[model samples]
Target chain A: MSYALSTLWFERQRYLPAVLAVAFSCLLIALQCGLLLGLFSITSIPIDESSADIWVAHPDVPSVDLGIPIPEAWQSYLAVPEIAHTEPYIEGFAYWKKPTGGTELVLIIGARLGPDSIGAIRQLTPELRMLLSETSSAVIDEGEFTRLGIEKVGDTAEILGKRVRIVGTVSGLRSLAGPYLFCSLDTARKFLNPPPGQCTFILGKCHDKEDAPKVVERLKAHPRKLYPFTTQDFSFHSQMHWLTKTKAGIALGLAAALGLLVGAVVTSQTLYSATVASLKEYAVLRALGIPRWRMAMMVVSQAFWVGIAGIAFAIPTIFGIAFVGAEVGAKIMLPYWLLIFATSITLVMAMLSGLFALRSLRMVEPVTLLR
Target chain B: MRADGLPLTPSMKAWGLTRSYGSGDTKTYALRNVSLEIYPGQIALLMGPSGSGKSTLLAVLSGLLHPDAGTVLTLDKDLWAMNERQREAFRLEHFGFIFQGYNLFPALTAREQLEMILKWGTGCSARDATARTSDVLTMLGMSKKAHLRPMQLSGGEKQRVAIGRALIKQPNFVFADEPTAALDWKQGQHVIELLRAAAHDQGSTILVVAHDARIIPFVDRVLHLEDGILYEGEERPMELYGGPTAPSPGYIAQ
Candidate 1:
């Protein structure tokens, strides 16, 4: 065995606590970070699904959820030669009444009448589209059916205390804000009682996909009170908007931060104990003319091995939990960045723990071996 | 090259050394103004009743403990006068040690124990250390059991491995504190013979802190400690040790 590894092998059994701490830290950090990321991912879900090339919102809006309605006259934006068309959309929180007399929180998205464009309802069959054109017909996310106590399509559910029939199901769209309820503009206006020709903001498409950036740039400098962003930028801004502006966003972020802190503390403590337990052996190394820093490095190497094992154990576990989270509609998103981030944090924590644990090393007098 | 090509310097020397514990009336002397010299290429036994300062003298002469007063030198380099780091380096460079309990790392196999020592010695590479480890373990009769960790080794085997570690470095001095205290008379005699062989082969001096009389025959000189005082006593002739008489070992003059 190589020197560091050989030495670590001898001390391997004793470092279980440290390794376990790192594993648990990985789990905690990944879970919290995954939650925050999952939350952030969905924060932009509506914009991404809508597939609009550009979005116009009031300058003061922080997030998509909090944006003030831009004037409907902004429809003049479509006159720009590069502009394809525009769809006005609306979204708001709704009290989804269950058949059992319990109410669930849901966000509703109104796909204002236009092309098959500018809405999260990616594919609406002609029959479903014809059905959604009516004021009383809407599609519910299938994931929400369990919570609404409805078993199949054509079931009646209540929105805003009004009986509404679930005419279809929108697949593959979920929100950290819970399942979304989608409908036509007429239905949303009838249900939400908003003024005619006034919607939250205009969703604009470019004539060519490549024209989107130029349109966004030109529209940004356009003489309008409205703020213009590419749909991608708008989605990004919306996520950031909620992340910084709302209590839920802050809570999710705080939860992630708390996970990191707990992981660090627990891992550090375990590593420190492991180091102290090996002081006698380290002292022998010290006596053998190993410099203090080299001895410190021995502790680091031990922690590194433990950290490696912990990552091996943790990454799969996080992915598995994320997979399960998908089924339950609770977002646990472990992207590549989060995996790298959590692993880096855990390794650093283990190393710092080893360094902190070296405090007891000074007492390991080689002469003590004689005693 | 005489390991440096100089007139022989004493392996270790100490004069007017004093070390004690506690303070005021509680300050009991462990070694009181002890003066001593051990020379090259011989096993020198330190014998004394319990608490007669044998351990303290070993510690002081080996640079494990600092003396309150007086100078101690190993290989003509002043040990007590060096800074703490320098003294530690001096000890690592010049001495090998064995403790009463064997003091072997439980996780290390017998070969590793010796290799680790050799690796730490000045100018030794891993390859060279491994080679030296093989040689020394064989010399100490531990080659067959070199793969066994300390927990698997017998008490006598552990002691031999510790001896191997000390010998593998070819140090200027080997200090074995009660090296054979855990062994039977035959094993103890065998261990002493190994120490003697190392001295003869490497020209390194050996200082054994022990009370066993059976080991007396194998040593070149004997020092007795009493109430913190140390003094040289008569050496056993080679006949007494079942061999032809040989010249007595020389020492550096005080």
Candidate 2:
């Protein structure tokens, strides 16, 4: 074992605060970001819970729910052999005149009700699809009944003065900005009343899902001004739109930065005091002609080991807390990339803390040991 | 004469050394025009009362502290003439130190304390460091306790580990400042014997600073300092034996 590690292990009590501080930083960064990701993930539900491999929409379309109407004829633009199927999808926000006399905004998501449809969400089972086939029939989230001011399936509500009846309900498909109203493309066309022969988006399915990007890139080269994104990319793009537009990313970033600052302070101070405690011993080494950088390396390596130990302590705790949050109906998304990002930044903060702690080494003058 | 039938020369020579602290009215001298020579294969004890110039002179000679005035020539190089980096390199190559307290790191084992110097200072391979550490531990009579940390060892054993750390590199010069001050007479004697062996057996120059007069019989020569002045002797001057008057200038022990 390295001298630094041995010292850290032997004096673990002395270094525990720094370790816990680092763990706290990692935990805060990861959990805050995870919670935010989970919260914003609802914004991309239309893109995520669909069979489409690629979504081709108007250039101005910012998010799935806020898409602009594009010519349905754009389906011909994706007529490559890689694209096996294509269909028009419609989504827009409209006020639902609840029967109880209050208006709640609802996003109307419309797609083909076919068994092998590319644009319909996977949650629309054959039975729900048959129900949605009825004119002006819609599917609502079971959890959003209170928000929509309705009690159960088959409840009648009016959208833009047109009467609509909820045919079924699905679990866990709740929206962030507004509750989702799932229905057939014709029903969405009647409610939204876009220009005839135009649709909100044109979604396509590739023979092999991995070929979606290549197909999108090919469609991008065409003269038409359109936006094409693979399903995963579209989901991320929609989530990022909401994240930045709502400024939640900035809030979470500041919280994570504050966590890093706390970790740095505690870690730097801990290393500084530990070095001070060993000042006399280091003075002896300095007197023996050992280079000061060698001692600096020892302190920095100790910081590195402290970072590793803290990360080791944090990863499992993050998953545990996230699990608990999930059980309590609070979604906390801990993706692999977010975990890597949180850990890497926290480790860098630890190393920089080590650098900050090096100022204490200047006090190690061998002349003081003589007295 | 050396064992090889060659004449011996001073391994370290310093002349006209002076150092002080504070400035102007608060200025006080720690060393004044102190001069000395230490030869290889010799253990010299530097004895003085509190505030004498012993440690100051030791610091100056060891290239640890810059003297206000004077030059120390060791191994044919001016010790203070080199820049800070060069001087530090020189010290790494040739200097070893033992201070009043056993300054071993509390977490490292006795063997690690000694091996750290070899590995970090000399960048020696781990295999070679372990070998040298084993040999030094054996010489210090600390091989059995090499696995123990400072807290696990007795005071004398800890001091022995410090001694082992100093001698591990087989340095040309070993400067010890009250190495035995924390040990009983028996342990202190053993510490002195280790330094003596390092000098006589390994041909290293050893300079020890201490207050205990009992150490007189163990070293080859004795030097006394009083109020920034230095004096050399085969033994301590009689003035230090409770004589009435202080030893005059140029006083030498008979």
Best by lDDT: 2
Q: Identify the CAPRI category of the predicted complex in candidate 2.
A: high
Note the Cα lDDT for every prediction shown.
0.74, 0.91
Interface RMSD of 1: 2.9
| Model 1: lDDT of residue A165 | 84
User: Ten consecutive residues with minimal summed lDDT in candidate 2 chain A?
Assistant: A217-226
lDDT of 2 by residue, B1-254 (tens): 66798777989888788899999999888887777778999999998889987888888999988999988999999999999999999999999999998988999999999999999999999999999898889888888998999999999999999888888889999999999898999999999999999999999999999999999999999988877777786444556554323333432221
Write one digit per residue (lDDT tens) for candidate 1, span A78-169: 56888877878877666778887788777767876445466645556666777788787888766778877788898887877788889888
Instruction: For residues A1-371, write the lDDT of model 2, one tens digit per residue.
Output: 99999999999999999999899999999999999999999999888999999999899888888999999999998889999999999989999998888999999999999999988889999999999999899998889989988898878999989999999989889889989999999999989998999999999999999999998888888898679999999999999999999999899999999999999999999999999999999999998889999999999999999999999999999999999999998899998999999999999999999999999999999988887
Cα deviation at A318, candidate 2, in Å, is 0.5
State candidate 2's TM-score: 0.96
Q: Residues B70-116, candidate 1, lDDT per residue (tens digit)? A: 88876678987789888778767777777776766666788877776
Error of 1 at B115 (Å): 3.5
Candidate 1 chain A lowest-lDDT run of ten:
A113-122
Off by over 4 Å in 2: B1-7, B234-254
